[model samples]
Structures are given as C-alpha cells and as structure tokens.
Target chain A: MAGPSTYVPKSGFERWLDARLPVVRMMHGQFIEFPIPRNLNYMYTFGGILMIMLVSQIITGIVLVMHYTPHADMAFSSVEHIMRDVNYGWLLRYMHAVGASMFFIAVYLHIFRGLYYGSYKEPREVLWILGVVIFLLMMATAFMGYVLVWGQMSFWGATVITNFFSVFPIVGDTLVQWLWGGFAVDNPTLNRFFSLHYLLPFMIFGVVILHVWALHVTGQTNPTGVEVKQKSDTVPFTPYATVKDLFAMVLFLLLFSYFLFFLPNYLGHADNYIEADPLVTPTHIVPEWYFLPFYAILRAVPSALGGVLLMFGSIAVLFFLPWLDTSKVRSGAFRSIWFKAAFWLFAINAVWLGWLGSKPAEGWYVPAMQIGTIYYFAYFLIILPVLGLFETPKPLPNSITESVLKKNGGQIASGAGQPAGATSAPETKG
Target chain B: MAFFSSRSLKSLVIAAAVALVPAGSAFAAGDSKPPRMQDWSFAGVFGTYDRAQLQRGYQVFAENCSACHALSRIAFRNLMEPGGPEFSEAEVRAIAANYFVMDGPDSFGDMFEREARLSDRFPPPFPNQEAAVAAMGAYPPDFSLLAKARAPTRGFPGFVIDIFTQYQENGPDYIYSLLTGYDEEHVNPEGELGHYNPYFMAGEYIAMAPPLFDGMHVYQDGSPETIDQYARDVSAFMMWAAEPHLEQRKEMGFRVMAFLLIFGGLVYMTKRRVWSAVDH
Candidate 1:
C-alpha cells in the first residue's frame, strides 16, 4: 500500500474516469490493496465496527426524524405513536437507541485497544487526537438525542447537566440561560436539542471520514505493535481483514439484536416513558450508562467547580496521552510486568468508577468515587510518565515477520532479514 | 489484575458486560429496594404475552381502574389487534360505542357528544390534571404508559443477572407490588386518606390510594378474581397498553437472531477459509 500504485484501469471509460478523478484509485489503494499486519486480532476489527455503527445510527436517526415531533408538547406522544401506530417504527426506534449503546461499546473497545497497543504513539498522535474529538462529539450527540425523547429523565437530565454550567463565575447563570434559552429546561431547550441531535451526527460522520483518512496515513497497529517492515509480514486489507471484520460484525449484530428486540427498554430508564413535566422531578437523575464514569468523577470532589473540572479533565487528559506516557515501548505485551499491572488495574478501576457512579453519591460510595477519581488521574499523570522512566520493556523482535514466525514456534521466516535482539534500543526517553 | 486470566476471552467479555450493566437509573427514582422479581408469562427471550390473560387483564382495567385512570394512548381498534386482547371487530365497535366521546361541530359551530368511533382514543375521566388533582387531592397518573413509567431498583449483582435472565419486567413488577402492597402491615397512610406505599418512587406518599381488592372483578373466564389476581391482571393489562407490540417484537427478535447466528457461522467459516493461507 505504501509503495507506488499498481492499479491499472481496465477499460476505456475506466481509464477516462481514472484520468479525470482518481476516486477508484484511492479506494483501491486504501481498501483493496491496503496492507495490515497479519497478526491483527479481534480488537483491530472495532474500527470497522465503529464505522458501521455510525452509518446505522445516521440511517435510523433520519427515519426517526420523519415521524418524531421535535416540539416538547408532542415529543413524548410522538414516540409512543411510533411504537404503537407506525409500522415497524418500534423496530427502528429500538435499533437507533440500542445502536447508540452498541456504538459506544465498539468505541470503548477501539479506544482501549489503542491504549493497549500504543496506537497513540508517534506518527499516530493526530489520528488519536481526532478520535478524542469524535468521542467528544459522540457524547454531545448522545446527550442531545436522549433529551429529544422528552421523558421525565429527558427533562431532568437536561436540567441537571445544563445546570453544571452554572458553577462557573459571574457569567455562569447567563451561560446556563443561554444554554437553556430560558430560565429552565423547557420547549426552547428541547427544540435546540432536537435540532443539534440531528445535526451533530452528520458532523460526527464528517470527522469519521477524517478519522479513517488519518488512520490510513499512519496505518493500523496490531497486537504485536511492531510497525510493518515488509509486505510479507502483512496481508491485503480485502479477503483477510474484510472477512474478519465481516465475521465480527455479524456477531456484534447478534448481540445488538438481542438488546434491540428482546430488551429494547433495558438500556433506557423507565421514567423516560412518562412525559416530561417541569413540575415533577424523578428522585434520581442519572445520565445514560456511558456517562456514569464521568459522572462519578464529577461528584468525587466536594467543590462543584472542582468536580466539573475533574470530570472534564478525565477526558481532556486523554488528549495528552501520547506525550504523557514516556515509555518508548509499544504494546503492554512487551512492557514490564509493573506496567501491565498498572494498565489492567487502571482499566478495572475505570469499571469500578462506572459502578460507583451509578450508585447514589452517599455513604461509602462517595469516598470510593474520590479514591477511584484519584487513581483515574494518577494512572495517566503519574504512573504512565514515571513508570516509563524506570521500567524495562521486554526485548522486541527484529521485525513484524520475525514476531509472527516466533509465535508459530521457531519457523524460519525468510522475510525477516535482520536477526532478533541484534538491534537494541533504550526504553527510556533519556 | 490477571493479565491473561484462565479462559481470558470469555472472562474479558463478562468483565466488559459487567462494567456496562445498566448503570445509574433504576426503573424510576432512587427507591431503596428493588421490586420483587416476578415470573411473568412474557418475561424471557421467547416469552409472549398470553392472549387470554391479556383479555382478562383488560377486563380488570375496564371494571375497576377506568373510573380514574385513562388509557388515552389506546384506541378501541387496538383491542382487536392480533397480539393484544384480540377482540372481534363487532365487539370492539360495541365497546367503542359504549363510551360517549366528544364529537365535532356539524353544520353549526358547536360541539356535541356521540358514540366513540374505533379510531377514537379512550377519554379521560377528568377534564384535566388540575381538575383531577382538585377532585382527588392528587392527580391520577395516566395509565397509558404507567406500566413503562414505573420501575423499582434491582440492586448490584442481581441487576447484572437481569440482563441475561431477560428480566425487563420492572415496571409490571413494581406496579403489582404497589397494588398488592396495600396490606396494612406494609402500608403507611398519612392523615385521613393520604396513601403511602413503600413501593412508591416519589417517597412522600403514593398519591393514588389502593385501587385493587379481593374479587375486584368477577372473572368470567374462571380465572381467580382475588386481590393478587386483580393486581397481576391490571398490571399485565397496563404492560400491554404500554407496549402493544411485545409479542410481535419478541417473535421478530427470534427470527432476526436466528438468521444472524446462522449467517455468522457461515461468515466465520468463510473467514477461516480466507485466512487459511495467512499466518496471523
């Protein structure tokens, strides 16, 4: 894929179009002939899964908009109408709703895969940063989408999350009013949310194009984390990665259908069934499952502003991940045991944070979130930077081909020209 | 952290699924206890709403609950739908005509009451929420989506299992609990007539007084008409009203899942064939 184009236009029209516009060439080079590390595992399939999810969300969302009422007064009934009256409308709504959750699942897997394999390091930093941007866009989109339902949770979730802005200084209240378009989360808020909820997915679609473009530039990282050294060490994107991704997608759809059909309302709050009423508020105002970890982080601090900052910081810190982790080694498999322990613990602590976030911020739950919050930050700011300075990474293979051969139990790989362990580099930045 | 725990693949899936288990929201508010899990006729992957039971449930709703509650979302025609109560067309027309729905101004600019059409929604007993509140000291919640609107907590590890076990009946379970919860032992009535059931999400008091009782409705189908039976029936009816497509959905879900599983198997085989020459 990195080499000169081997594409040959087949016919007269093809040649003419190829000369006028090189779209076919681009697709051919980017997809058909693209080189991916042969050792790529199930984790590597999530990028494709994410792309499909984005498309699924957009399609389902657009269909929903046709029947969905954006007005606060009618939105709740409109949803019920879709479920009850519209033909196959319930199926579409559930697909879109469950698709959102499934999209997050794929994205989380993709991000964690990147972290585990050090896909964020060096030349891939721009791709990683673009991903973080997409993540932000996704959160905003999901938040707005949830509010458009105009359920009790929708009303209060809009109220509570928007109220987070009021913790700022002199302009706090003003900023909130601007956000709400009124003194409270009312029709105007719902209107704007509906508009943006529709608009943001397209914006996400645009960023995803760039995301893929950037990914192609740096290429994909495999579980081995060794950069592509030769063509023999990798396989063509089609007939290999495509087949693998297709298989994974089918399995993913199976899981998704389970939720979409049998358990449509499982991911949703029951209160959402109740129409939005400004006069009434449910006792618990919890965001969707995706936001729980961040919500916990927000509540970890006693100070409201501090909590908000920390919550935002949890995501913002990810932007600096490439530089924060001083380790020269890529992939946890090759990193020292301490690094492995820290990384997995970091992952588990995050899950714990999500669990804690779901519970009310009372009793020991509050203190547990505080501790989890500290570790969440400590993993990025402290452990990552400090561990890289002292920990020794395991010896790396001479090339991707060599690693593949080693895994196959000492088969001699003629493609691996250089001897293993012959070329050694220091793990530390210094 | 077991970096490569025994059976790493399966464990990893469980760990991730556990992490994402329905966090934050219960059915509704931050109620202290989860509703008792019930074994519903329609509670699993293949579960379908029992047709006969749904009809009986509708009977309970029409007889006891209809005076205060409004199933405004339900049209008379909906009762004739295949998956629902499945009442005949003539029967549904008879049921519709039984109610006097507000009709339109004819040639003159005036409104009049007439027999409800099949298309007409079930009318509310009260003119509006304010009127209902004034009449009853608290506004009666609309029964249309009430079954979907209420869900008690299913705490910790138990809630996690609810996902696989397909326990999506929190709404019906909570409703049944509240209806039967009028037992004096667990009931907490405030002042003269203020009813407060511990099962209520709003904490202060269950604004609606206990509506169900023994022999609430004489069951013509020979089904028991005890307080428990009535509560269960009404709750089930409410669930049907809230999600009329439950049977169709579950049926459709099974077909889709089966197709995907078989297709996935083929794709897996193709993938294996495609990658046979490669050494990943």
Candidate 2:
C-alpha cells in the first residue's frame, strides 16, 4: 500500500481545491485503479442508467415545484396552467410526466437484470436489497405525486387505494380513517400526500447512495460466469464502463424524448382534465401504466383482503430471493436447463398478469389471473429450489480471461501453467 | 486479510447505522400526520368555483386535466351547442383529429376532428365498462352529475361545517379568498384549525393550487397581464363549465312536472271510454 506523501502545489487554486475535495485523486484511485471484468454486457449498464434517471427526476421535480399548486381544487387547473400558460410549460410538463414513466421503465429493467445475472448473490445481496428498497420508495412517491394533481383520477385513485385498508380484519376502518385524516379522501389527504411526495425523493436519493456503495463493495458481476483473477483479466472502470454507460443512457434518452415530444399524452387518461367530483364518480379509473402488473395481482384474488395481501406479497417476496434460489451456481449462463426454462416461463407469466390487469374482470379473466398469480409465486418458491437440486449445469471456464479467449477462438497463452479446470474449485469453496 | 475484514466490518456498521436512523425516526413519528396544505392561495386553486365558466373553462380544463381526471357525464355532442363555450365545430374537429375512435365489426377505428356526429361521444379509454372498473378498482364518476350532487350549500350547516373544516370562504367569496389568501403565518393561534394554506379560500388547507398564469389566454384582441385577473377569469369559466345547462335544466324540470300532472288527468278521462262497453 502506498503511504500519503507531502505535496507541493504550484498554484493557490490547486492547493485550495486539494484542501476542499481531493476529488481527482479519489476518482483516479477508485475508478481508474479498480479492476473489473472485461466481458460485461449491456445489462451491467442499468445501474448507471438508473442513476441518470434519478437525477433527471430530481431536477425535473424541482422545476415543476416552481409552478405547481399543491391544493386539491387548484391542482388540476394549475397543471392546466402549466400546460397552456407557462412559457414552454407544455414541454416541461410533458417531459416531467413522461420522464416518470421512463424512470419506471429503467428500474424494471434494472431489477430484472439483477434477477437474470444473479447479481443479488452472496456479497451483492445488500446491493440488491437496497435496490428493492429504492423500488418501494419509488412506488410510494409516484402514487402520492399522482394525488397532488387533484384531478378526477387523482381523487378516485386516492380514495380507492386508501380504502384498500378497509380489507384488514379488525382495525381496517380505523386504519383507513388514519390514512385519510378524515371520513373521506378529501383535503387533508391531498395535503399530506403533497408533503410526503416532496420528501420521499430525498429518501430515495439516500437509498440510491447505499445501493451504489453496496455495488462498489461486491463489484460488478459479468456474463461469462467466471470471476476476476489476475489484473490482466480486468480493465479500469473509468473510460471503459463510463463510456458504455453513457452510450446506453444517451440511447435511452432518445427513446424518452420521442415520447415527450411526439405523443406527450399518449400514455395518459383523458378524463383527468375534468376537476375532481367526490359525488359523481367517473365510469372508469385506471392506475398509471407502470403499476398494471401489481394491480392485476390485487384483482386476482376474490376477497379484498386476500387481494391486498397477494399484491403486497408479490413485491415482498423479492427480499427472500437470495435465500430461496438455493442454486450453487450464481450466473444464469451456468444454470441448468430446467432453471433457464423456468425463468422464461416466469417472465411470460408476469407479462400475462399485466395484460390481465388492464382488462375487465369477467368470464375467463379471473381464472387467468389466478393462474398467472400462482405461477408468479411458484417461480420463486418451487421452481428455483427444485431446479437447483436436480438439474446438471454446463461446464464453466477457469477465469474471465479464459472465457473471453474461448469466445474469440484463441487458445490460452503458452506457459501460463494455471490449470483451465481450476474455475469450479473457488466456486465450490464459496 | 485484516484489512479486508476490518473494511467489511466498517461497511456493515455504516449500513446498519444508515438503516437504523430512518427506521427510528419513522417509528418515532408514528404515522406522522399526513402533510396538510399550508398556504391559503393553494387551497383556493383547488376549491370548486362558480357555474358560468363551464364552456371556455372546459377547454382549458380539457387541455390540462383530462390526462389525470375523468368527467364521464359530458358528451361530444354537448360541445356543439351555442351555449357551449370552449370549442367551435372546426376547433372540436381539430382537437378530435388527434385521437382514433374505434367503430364497427372490423375493429377498425378512425380519427375524429370537426363536428362530432351522433355516434361521437367521448370515446371510452378502455374496451368496456367491466375493463375500466377492473383496472381502476372503481368506476370514475361522470362530470354531468358532479355539480348537482356536490354543489355547496349556503345555510347554517354549511357555515358551521365550513368554519370547523377550516373552510374560510364559500362560493365566489370562497374562490376569491382561496386565490388571494396565501399566508404562512395565518395559522389559528389556538391550534383549532390546522396549517394555513395560502391557496385555500376559507383559510383552510387545500390540495389544489391557484392555476392561473400571468397571461394564459389572450382574448381575441389584447388582455391585461395579471395572475389574479386570470385566476378570476378561469374561476368564472370553471363555474359555467361545470354546469353548462343549469338554468335550462331547472326550467325544463318545472315544465315537465306540470305537463305530467295535466297528462295524468287526461289519461283518467280516456279510461272511461274504454270501459263503457264492459260497464254492463
């Protein structure tokens, strides 16, 4: 290890900057000197992409706060004023609105990437857990923010959600009252939602920091199912990972921009323009698109309480994922055929659930939801553990370097005496 | 090995500490009272207003609120009435042009713009009623019935309730109070009312804001620059927008009731003619 040496600065500004930050040195030591696997794919870029989205949300939200009115009556109209009255307000409003959908899109992909790569395994467990926390917070913040608009959908959505507590066994009504701060979802409810919505993003920011910290501790996992060994097996993170992440982020922005400019309200509901009316309910009330899957889960069960529990369980089960898989291998590349097939089945089941959620519950809808709901749980509990014990995995290379060489159709360098078969040994030790 | 172990321990401690602080605070807060609107101006913006602005207000409302709120009562044909304020036939067509309305057995849909024909009520977002309810947990209420059902009262109960609920004003007074009533220090000294919301009319907290910009719409010629003036104008627009046919509905209701009474007497007389042959 190198010891700190006395430094002589030639300029006053250099001394001042060094005294305050030492940012350059820290960046050099942490990123430039850090060793990372060379064979990482685009999937690894999601965390960085998520970070970009987080920053975008914070910036856009702050700008929106400048013009937004948090009162229930004015919220709907104020949003209108933003669209019609503010200079370029329409663009800002559309971007922020669409940006929210884009954020969720990125987060869903990030979470699925973790699942596919087994990025939550062993040392990376905490990182994945923090990511889950971030996910929960994001849901809460988004839901509350929706209520801040005070539109018909906003009002009815709040009423429906707060009323979900009424399904609880004994204290349900009390809980609902507690949530609403009144007999109905009215002014108090709106006020509180605004405050919490304003505060939660900061909490998300903190959790995100923890997420990145945890990632740094465990390091990133690569696609080849081989661990980093020698310095030659890896590359520095700065120019390599940074460039790739930036490229992915730019590509994502292009997609988001297209939606923001061309089809601003394409994903939105038309009824929201009417102000909130507690007495005369709109004929239909659908939640934001991102929540469709879980919304389907809520409707799957016949009983209200049962539906709520199942909906919550769908997300809560993610915390137990590390323990439930029971697989000796971490990466999907090395997983058995049965496990691979099960993963795809689970993905299809989730998509089916989202589709079912959007449809009216009638005839075949309920039964279909029930089946999708069962598969959703079965994938985590039964399939993972059973596949781990019975199925046989394919052979894996000794190190990341060897895996890449094999892919490139090149032999290992001569006289490097490290046995090609030694890869499974360290894994077994783990 | 020592370095790695100590560093890991440090990381664990840091993580534990980070998690603990928030958890502790959250528990201490113990379901901290949900945030209340603190300013009066914000409350006024959210409060329901007069019935006159229904037409022109609907246009502004449609441009902004439709994405999140649903008004089920009003139909496409309603916009064509002379009394309807927001859009002319050409404008309605232009506005509808952007959307595709599903029709016929082919499952093919065409874009709407211009005058809405008889079949052209606002298109339902979902396929049918069942789907909408399934997705949202409840049917979104229609706007046509909204003003009638939830219209503010003017008597003692209304006054007492308004006072207790921290509603500082009512009707036009309420609207005016809300738009201009923002103040951070307007909290009740006795702690009877909650936080003072600047946007609220009655000095109570509200979930809406006063939504007028300094110069949102330029009336055909030239309009003055003032946010307050715009707020009042929009509020007037909202009143009429909510109940476009209030006067007509009241007048028709009375006339129909009178016509029903006379029709009942005539039906009673006709009954004797049919029974004359059977009377023996």
TM-score of each: 0.92, 0.60
lDDT of 2 by residue, A264-307 (tens): 44455544555787664554456777887887788776666788
| lDDT of prediction 1 | 0.82
Model 1 CAPRI rating = acceptable
Residue A402, model 1: Cα distance from true site in angstroms: 0.8
TM value for model 2: 0.60
Candidate 2 chain A, which ten residues in sequence have the lowest lDDT sum? A421-430
Question: In terms of TM-score, which candidate is strongest?
Answer: 1
Q: Which stretches of candidate 2 lie over 4 Å from their true place?
A: A1-23, A414-430, B1-280
TM-score of the second chain in each model?
0.85, 0.43
Task: Pick the DockQ winner.
Answer: 1
The sequence of per-residue lDDT tens digits that candidate 1 reaches over residues A169-248 is 79777898799786677789999998899899999989989999998888888777778877666777776788899999
- DockQ of the candidate models in sequence: 0.29, 0.01
lDDT of 1 by residue, B1-280 (tens): 1243323422332222222233334533655455666778888877878778888888888887888888899999999998888989998898888898887787798899988999999998998999988998888889989888887766788678978888889899988888877546554434545565667776535667778777758888898878888888778888999989999999999999999999999999999876665556
Q: Can you give the lDDT of residue A14 in candidate 1?
A: 88
The TM-scores, chain A only, for the candidates as listed are: 0.95, 0.91
Task: Please list the residue runs of candidate 1 whose C-alpha ends up more than 4 Å from where it truly belongs after superposition.
Answer: A413-430, B1-34, B105-107, B185-192
